[model samples]
Target: MRNEKMNTNPDAVRQPLLQVSNLAVDFGTVDGVVHAVEGVDLESAPGETVAIVGESGSGKSTTAMAVIGLLASGGRVAGGSITLDGRELVGISENEMRRIRGRDIGMVPQDPMSNLNPVAKIGTQVAETLLAHGLANRSTVQQKVIEALSAAGLPDPERRAKQYPHELSGGLRQRALIAIGLACRPRLLIADEPTSALDVTVQQTILDQLDEMTRELGTAVLLITHDLGLAAERAQRVAVMHRGRVVEQGPARQILEDPQHPYTQSLVQAAPSIAAARLQPEVFQTGREQDAAADAVADNIVEIEGLRKVYPMRGSASDFVAVDDVSLAIPRGKTVAIVGESGSGKTTTARMLLKLIEPTAGTIRFEGNDIAKLDRAQSREFRQRVQPVFQDPYSSLNPMFTIERLIAEPLEFYKRGSRAERRSRVRTLLDDVALPQSMLQRYPSELSGGQRQRVAIARALALSPDLIVCDEPVSALDVLVQDQILTLLGDLQKEYGLSYLFISHDLAVVRLISDYVCVMKDGALVEAASSEEIFTNPRDPYTRRLLASIPGNELGIAS
Candidate 1:
């Protein structure tokens, strides 16, 4: 019904705008030629959406990259047929592909922060696409840029065009990327996890705008994502990929209702859906009073009272208030999650708790000691006791270091044990985090995103910290990997009594992992309650909106 304006009639016979047949892609690694995608077949009609759904390393992105002729270095189409508008594209030259790129096939890559030019203004980037494609000249480029941004649902497009990517939030940056991708009004749009990093409300807004624009343009879409709920909601057809192959392909609703493949079934089960019950029901079954009584018996691991952070602008009279009078507590061995959109002060609050940034005002008490007033020795002890597992595992782990050394770095810094003992500890930590001991020799680049995140967790656990600040730890991960990581975190907490300061934009994830949830908006706490209370009976309007915006809420079908 959401796609009624577009051509989504399955019974109608029509030529596909884009097509691929028996596509195989290979990457020349140091070891050998690795087949990344094999015998894959896909197609998308004009004004239709086809989603490739899979876990990380399942070759969905590789397929998209191959389609766009932008495969990474040493990757090539080993054997495949790729046709766009009835034109073969497998053997096109770089020049020919460049001409086809913006004019016919536009891409909205994942991680807008990386895809966007950090130094270039938003308008300049949009103008480059239009100019390169001969869609706009210098005289009309500015107007075109503003129009593109406005079409992408960006507010105040004129001011936004003059600003750089860093000046925008994640959602805004994603909108800017959308603006750039659609500037030339391409026939086919390849969106690779475009909304994976965004909050639910923002994701809904972006997807709605994309649907509307693509419907109006009659553009075909190749959506590459790991989210089953997203695919079910957005795509007409879903192609399920696993280990370099399309294992199943069918209508989205049919795939969701009666998935034949075991992998597809697993994906549906693992995905955190709004309609599904919490993963850890026991954590909620214990009454809030009992948990509070336990916390009263044992001290809260960390406490914040009227915490605030202000960044002074060079010329602005009113300083930027990042975290305004935010106050919360993390009970010992319990997970207290902060859920908010980008720039909502959740991460800033976590950074302050980790002592990475000094708060402008208020108090942060860790284990009954004021962290701000700690002595040199006490500060060192606090640093050792509280560690962080940052977002973006791709950047968090040191590429040059082996997984062994990366985990051992904190142990070595703390002088926890002898060389042999630290190596053994690293192995143990890997085991604790569900990583193989054999991975100790591999570098970060050699591992998948989930494995890299596990390594980051191992490194964080190496310090034996009482509190771990997880800032969107699983945001970029697939549902299965995210479920694994969340389960691992819960198991580790139970085993080690580790407290967590979890910050994320995903309410489903927060519901699954958190004992308590703090909802933040515009640099302030709007609601704080038990996870059960927040999810079932949220009092705040923003919280209700976030819940409503979750992908599967409308479907109401159990995963």
Candidate 2:
């Protein structure tokens, strides 16, 4: 109930850094007019961090783009006013907007890979922003770039500046983007899902850096994200958006503790840390039952013994051991979560399990058959039983195919049924994933991130396979939608008795769905234990560190 008025003066009343009111945007296309944003009102006072929370297509990103005057071609700002320090921005010519952008307001886009030019060196990109804003000359830009990288928490900034975008990790690339945004010392910084692609540790580091930089520079921030936990952790105020409108806005504590809207409530409740809210004694009793069942059925649906994968170093003294002597068993109808940092061999293990690459040494067994020895025909059959849901939904589904076609491809390739039966099956799968039947004809480009992921899940289930390797399936989804998907997976497991080898770095999520947990570090399994055991009494220091890294754990939010 903090009613802070938006400051209208550019130099008086400590001046609100940015003000946006009744904004609307539309994209005219061949099919129809796409209403991207509508009637959105937001503001950020000097040195305040405000978070915009919503599911995809809720106008969060579009609103930010509109404020910065960066909407794509054919995308028109249909209505509203945007003022940066009382300077009108809506309807301003591109040339005027260009002069304002990067100098007064800066943006950090979602995907680092696509946002940073692949061909440009990291230092040059940051320095170019400074030069364009007339902040520094070519000679001084290099020094400024290094300082900016260092300020962004990138290690060895001097060397990192010389490297291209591809050379840095996902976390580093995101930091590089931030460095470029902060290079000019803009009064307002807009970050759109900056940590969506990073692992948990890297994400924590980046967020911490943002908080520190904001405090130091006294910069106003507009953070756009689907992760409510992150918003609660970083922002002072939260705005909840849905269906192209802001449904609720309040202080961060009020929104997190007592959400006024049902959507906001569901978002907080759906968080894995919050969902696992029962008493410790109750969870322990459930764990006992799980332990007994695990002992009764110890047979492996998929097993990897002494697996090793090596990548030859380019003109180096030694090769890299991506997966070193990794051994594990995935039991039927059970969920095994593999938790690790980036480059810790989690994805490599998944790739090896899929037989995408032959292991350097060891055996992989699928239902008692050695998949490593399988021929082309046998490998195709194996693919049917073990399907994968990739991390990025945007790239996983084809842009040209309709939802029905995408889901039906697996069934058609396997020749499971007649054309009529296949169509019925596709409809059923879509329904199972809680998608509308009207979405059948829409392509991947038409759907939101969560919807596209649901379609991917529907396709994965089309095969009716025994095992599914979900690779960070819910990482890209909003909290509320993620809960629905996790609940759907649980229901599907009960119905079909399917087995899953879930991989993720989100410890809270791993605790929610996994029966067992395997901790990996440096391409090796550091520890393996039941979920309850792992949470209650972690024997390894690394495991404890990972658990400590989870936000809200120390604050009793997990309760």
* TM-score list, all predictions: 0.95, 0.89
Give the per-residue Cα lDDT of candidate 1 at 184. 87
Q: For residue 141, give model 2's deviation from the true position in Å.
A: 3.5
Q: Of the candidates shown, which would achieve the greatest TM-score relative to the real structure?
A: 1
lDDT of 2 by residue, 223-321 (tens): 998877677767778899998899899887678788989988766776668236221212342445655765887577988899899999766699999
Provide the overall lDDT of each model, using Cα atoms, as 2-decimal numbers: 0.87, 0.82
- The root-mean-square deviation over C-alpha atoms between each candidate and the true structure, in angstroms, is 2.2, 4.1
Clashing residue pairs, backbone N/CA/C < 3 A, model 1: none
lDDT of 2 at 512: 76
